[model samples]
Target: MMRVKPSAFVMLAYLIFLLLPIYWLLMMSLKTNTEITSTFTLWPADLTFRNYQTILTDPSWYMGYVNSLIYVGLNTLISITVALPAAYAFSRYRFMGDKHLFFWLLTNRMAPPAVFALPFFQFYSAFGLIDTHIAVALAHCLFNVPLAVWILEGFMRGVPKEIDETAYIDGYSWPRFFVKIFMPLIASGIGVAAFFCFMFSWVELLLARTLTTTDAKPIAAIMTRTVSASGMDWGVLAAAGILTIIPGALVIYFVRNYIAKGFALGRV
Candidate 1:
């Protein structure tokens, strides 16, 4: 018999810790309200699709999904567009105040969302962008861009400078080089960065809830509305929560290969 490595055991333990909450959520989503509240059952006593049906049939719930998808998509696009150039510059150039600028960019990620919530609301209201998809997208960008830059910068650093020099020597313009040659090399990095951006913006509630009202509010905001004067609809909420994970799960699965490669390159 082969002995198990300590590192493998540690990783297995950590994986379980990370997935425990998600496991609970999935189990709850599958259970009936009576089964959930009457007693603690390790598994669902009665498995039903009623909760999922409620979400799909309700306009309010479906709209929240639409709103969340639009805003997160916009946020990811904007983050990647800006971060690509900034990351390339940071990785390739050594200019005045470069390190300071890099740290300054990262500082945005460190800022508490609560602190900026009010200001964001007021600013968007003044611009007549309140309760709109763009407002949420832009608000998310404050953090997403910084994160994208940081992640992409690490991946960009791993890429050999010789490639850029070689492209230039071959008479390739900067834009052509980046689009055709360099972009493909760091494709895995871009995938990872975009995945993180989408995941964070999708799950974040405070800013998304504050920035949008009824019409364009995200699923996260809709989840908050589950608690009301009548009572908390745990079943609907659980179902909505489960549905919310689908898009992210599909995205991660599609990019799983790239994600593994990107992290293996020491860019995580």
Candidate 2:
């Protein structure tokens, strides 16, 4: 028999430590309440699909996921759109207090979501925009825009200034150059920025829960419904947790290469 390396054992232990919770959640999702509460098996003794069935068939459960996707998508689009020009300006130009302005923008991202939650609620309430997808999307932009700008600026700065001059000399209009020539050069950066924006908006519960009532309630808020007169719906909650991980997993899968490039600071 071959001897196992200590490092391999450590790596295996680390993986188990990381994956144990997820595995437990999956097991719980497959078990009924009785099996879950009474038994402590590594795998489900009596597997059931009722929990997943309930979530898929119920509008309230399904709609929470829809609402989350809507706001997260909207927030990602708005953040990337607003950050592009702002990042370009910061990367290529200098003006009065430009550094200060950039720092101030990042300060907005540093601030806790709770600090702005009440103010956001009041502002949206005044405009009658509460409980809408746009409201949550806009609220998330407060943080996402700054983060997107900071990230995109780093990648933009990695690009040479000669490209802009060359494009301008070729009689390329500003919009034409930015969209056609410049954007593609920093495509990986954009992917990284969009990924962060989507993740922040997707996982952020405070602003999403605080801003919406029923109409635009996100899955994060709806997950609280597991507790009731009948006690906690552990099976359904676990199933929902599994479903929640899928979208983010899919996103990371598609952008894995771009994300790798981003880690290398946009190098070829």
Candidate 3:
């Protein structure tokens, strides 16, 4: 048998550090309450499906998943749609305050979600948009839009200027050239931006919780309700946490290839 190198051992150690908590969460989700409390077993003494069942069957809990999907989907769509034009403008044109404006856009992402929660709540309530999916979706755009702009700008900047000049020389209209040529060239950037937007909005708790109530509450908010007068239902919370990772995990799995390609565009 061949011995492993020091670099290989270091990589294995890092992988363990990253995956150990996830493994523990999965184990906790499988265990019964008694097993969780009484024994610190590496594996569950009795594996049960009840925790998953509880989450899947309950309307409030399961509906939170649906609500999160809806808002996250909408947030991604809005962020990409808005960012595309802004990113193109920033990459292609020089306008008044363009540099300052680009930096200003990123400032929104730096604002603590907690600081804006109250103002968001009030602003939405004033418009009678509170506790709605659209409210959360729109609020999330504050951060997602800036991130999308930054990512897409890098990708757009990589496209050769000759491509635009050639499109004009060939008599292609701006809209036609953008849709038919420019978009395809940056598909990987769009994929990366969409993934980030979806992931951030899906996992966001503070604004999502503040902007929604019964009808539009997210799973993260629902998980907070697990603490009751009796006790914390660690199993249910674990199950909910596990389920929350599903959408993000799926998004990343599909776009994993694009991540490297997208970043490559930035380097160019």
Q: Write the per-residue lDDT of candidate 2 for residues 88-171, one digit (tens) a residue.
A: 999999989999999999999999998998999999999999999999999999999998998899899999999999999999
lDDT of 3 by residue, 1-268 (tens): 9987999999999999999999899999998878888889998889987999999999988999999999999999999999998999999999999999999999999999999999999999999999999999999999999999999999898899899999999999999999999999998888888888988888788999998889999988889888999888888888888998777787778988777765553555
**lDDT agreement with native, every candidate:** 0.89, 0.93, 0.90
TM-score per prediction, in order, is: 0.89, 0.95, 0.96
TM-score of 2: 0.95
The worst-scoring run of ten residues by lDDT in candidate 3 lies at 259-268
The alpha-carbon deviation from the true structure for residue 259 of candidate 1, after best TM-score superposition, in angstroms, is: 3.6
| Top-TM-score structure, candidate number | 3
Error of 1 at 238 (Å): 1.5
Ranking by TM-score: 3, 2, 1
Local distance difference test, candidate 3: 0.90
Candidate 1 accuracy as TM-score = 0.89
lDDT of 1 at 162: 96
What TM-score quantifies how close candidate 3 is to the native fold? 0.96
| Residue 63 displacement (Å), model 3 | 0.4
Ranking by lDDT: 2, 3, 1
Distance from true position, residue 121, model 2, in Å? 1.1
